[model samples]
Target chain A: MHPQLQLLVALQDMTGMIKEVEEKGSELEGMGFKTAGLDDLKRAREELEGQIEPQLMGAFQRLTAKFGRAVVPVVGNHCTGCFAQIPSSFVSKTNAGKLQRCESCGRILYWP
Target chain B: MDIAEVLKNTSPELFLPDLKATDKESALSELVAGLTAGMDIKNPDTILQMLQSRESLGSTAVGPGIAFPHGRTLAVQRLTILMARSTAGVDFDSEDGEPTHLFFVLIAPPQDLGHQYIKSLATLIDTVQEASLREKLMAADDYEAFCAALRGE
Candidate 1:
């Protein structure tokens, strides 16, 4: 994976964690797990986002707002985000292929 | 898509009754090492990194002695749950300030953002809250007993 894409993946994971905790706080509390430091998690997401370039991060943010996952894996030449077929040209062994967006969902695509 | 699916995917190898790790990193390493085969991507390191990044945000330790260390990543093809009992206990920096005896690592593909992923976690959390379940798990000498205990039998 490209280092930038890798960083984006990390940021998305962080964002997902925070969102789940917020969305599931009551259920988590029912099981006795403390849902604290969510703000700290947001801070961590910001810190991670700072590492990515503005242009890429802007696209990421826009796509994530439209669709829950900004970055998605390409499985069997199909975008897992929207299940659209990714063209063969974009699917390559090179790291740059992972940094491209799915023409269908516009979600960033990467090979798992 | 359901707990049965999660159960269907698991075997005795994924359940450890005697984990040797004394810290979170080693415990995760041990669990990830045991679960590498489940990752379709064949990248256990990426799975481990995903787990660690989630932990870095906050300890997933919920109750007295159980921790639900979970995350989503491209490494896994489905909702993967690998559980272990740290006989010596591991410090996961729990909010309760107690040693975690039960460790349940939940990792899945990013596409399972809703429904199946969250439901699986909820089911696991509900199952572990039973005191009888914990007692039986601690006494389980093998996978069958551990599973039975998990089922509240």
Candidate 2:
């Protein structure tokens, strides 16, 4: 993974957890989610955001807002984000450590 | 997702009828090991780190001796829900302050096209919350009987 892609993937994971907690905070309360830790989650998100570049961070926010997720993995010559067949050459580009995105969903792609 | 289908496609190794971890983090480590042993997940250390981070926010152990520790990561290709029962019970910091007996660990790749991750999570939450099902789950002796019990057989 490209260094930036690594950070982006981690940030994406953090963002997903933060969003889920924010969206389902109430439903998760007695279900054993410490709703009190919502602030802690937000703080953790901010911490992750701090380590990422502003441009990439902006792109992540915009993309996740447009789609459900900001980053996805490439699974078997296909972009799992949009289920689109990725050209074989594109896989090489990603493997060469170039930043890549799914042409269909416009979501960032990482070779996980 | 059909539990039976997932189990069949994956392996019965994912089902741990008797868990050996006694604490929250250890139980999660056991589940993560089972996940890797049973499926084609890569980067389990990262998976364990993410799961621990989720637990730091809140204990998933709640409602009638059940714990649902779940996370989304780049490590997996699809949604996976694995079950493990600790006969002696693991202390998962349950909300009701009871020892957690049943564990449902949900792992998903970030690209959940059909939202199966959340939907399956909701279903598991609803299913295990029922006292009747929890009892059946605990009583199941092996993976096959466990699947049957889950399917209400």
Candidate 3:
């Protein structure tokens, strides 16, 4: 993966974790149970977000707002995020470590 | 935690005794659609993407015919859970190689506090640990039966 794509993937994962932690925290609070680790995850996400370029970050945020997950894996020449099959040429570009987006879903595409 | 209390706030309408999807992807889409229907979800497509992304990380199928397909997204106002059963069973890429029969779709907000969501998931997993409990849930004919079985009645 390209360096930026790598960072975006990590950022997406972190964002997902943050959401999970927050949900768990709310559940625990409802049960009168205390929890932790959410702040650290948020901080981590912030730091990760800061490391990416503004343009790329903007794209990520836009895609995330539109698709929930801005970065998704390309599985079997298909954008698993939207189930759209990409052309072989596009897959080659992705395999060559180029950043790509699914034409249908518009989520960032990476070769896992 | 008391299972009933933990799930008390969950909407009973989210539980589906007869899921209609024949595959994992379609099942997820169906579940998400059902969960977001009539709600103010900004983007149902995005929510489905989030859930699919999580599944790609690894199948949530724990074992014994149960799968917990969950995702965190800002599309919803708060944490939500939807449960469904596939009588015909669907391949969820379970590690155990068994077809998944029960699905607990959990959706949480991006900024959630974290306690209630985790606790609810843990409670659900623990409750279904009993083989009989799994059987009862699978055999439940209606929503009431499903709730009763979940409550260990």
Candidate 4:
């Protein structure tokens, strides 16, 4: 994977983690569980965001806000996020390590 | 290789019914605690963290009230599967926006060269995707019935 794509994948994973921790943090605190991981993940996300390209970062944030996941795997020519079948041309571009977005869902697509 | 065979190899002690947790984190902690008590796991906290990290990637809830929360960790010697059911349901952040009632927590070693881990995962996903089987599993009154449900009995 390209360094930028790798960074975006990391950022996406971190975003997911941050969301989960925030959503469940209060409930966990009520149960006496330490939520320090949430802070660490948030900081990590910020650091990752700094590494990604500005335009890509903006797109990522927008897609993540719209759909819980911004980067989705293309499995057998289908965008796993939206279950939409991607064109073979897009699949080839993704396989070539180009950062591409699904025409249907607008989520970043990668071949895993 | 089949899901029933996989469940058969897993300890009966891991199948839990009527789990009391009302939310995802508590439900996860409860399952990790069970693993700590029954298995050779040394650090429950670390294992819980790993599972939570995996959950952050996506809500494991595959749909129809079942969620598969899994992680690869160094704490286990082999692939370990723990099953739990919450009749009251828990907010697992499922894509369908419905409360989740069934959870299958799968823990695997960091290195699964034989590909047994993914195969088991695929089997679990295929098995649960069957609405009839899921219904039977959910309607089961006890562990034995649960096993029978998995066995397609």
Question: Proportion of native contacts found in each model?
Answer: 0.39, 0.49, 0.06, 0.02
- Give residue A48's error in model 2 in angstroms: 1.8
Q: Please estimate how well model 2 matches the true structure, expressed as its whole-model Cα lDDT.
A: 0.77
Candidate 2 C-alpha error for residue B30, in Å: 1.8
Model 1 chain A: ten consecutive residues of lowest lDDT: A90-99
Q: What tens-digit string does per-residue lDDT give for candidate 4 at B11-130? A: 778888888998988989998987787676644665676677666555677667988786555456578888889889999988788999998888775345564655676677767778
Please, what are the lDDT tens digits per residue for candidate 3 over residues B1-153?
A: 777865664566788778788788888888888787635564576677666666654577775788877655545546787888999988887777888999887777644555566667778887888998899999898877887888988
All models, RMSD in angstroms: 3.0, 3.7, 11.9, 13.9
Candidate ranking (TM-score, best to worst): 1, 2, 3, 4
Put down candidate 3 lDDT per residue, A4-82, tens digits, no spaces: 8767766775577666545554653443322344565566668878999999999999988987778776657888678
Give stretches of model 4 more than 4 Å off: A1-112
lDDT of 3: 0.72
Which regions in candidate 2 have their CA more than 4 angstroms from the true location? A1-4, A30-32, A53-68, A80-107, B1-11, B111-114, B129-135
Query: In terms of DockQ, which candidate is stronger, 1 or 4?
Result: 1
Checking candidate 4 for backbone clashes, the offending pairs are none
Docking class of 1: acceptable
Q: Model 4: how many Å of interface RMSD? A: 11.4
**On TM-score, who's better, 3 or 4?**
3
Residue B33 C-alpha lDDT in model 3: 82
Candidate 2 has an interface RMSD (Å) of 2.0
Scoring each candidate complex against the real one, what DockQ results?
A: 0.41, 0.44, 0.06, 0.03
Instruction: Name the 10 consecutive residues with the lowest summed lDDT in model 3 chain A.
Output: A28-37
Those runs of model 1 whose alpha carbons end farther than 4 Å from true positions after fitting are: A89-91, A94-98, A103-105, B1-6, B43-46, B130-132
CAPRI-style quality class for the chain A–B interface of candidate 4: incorrect
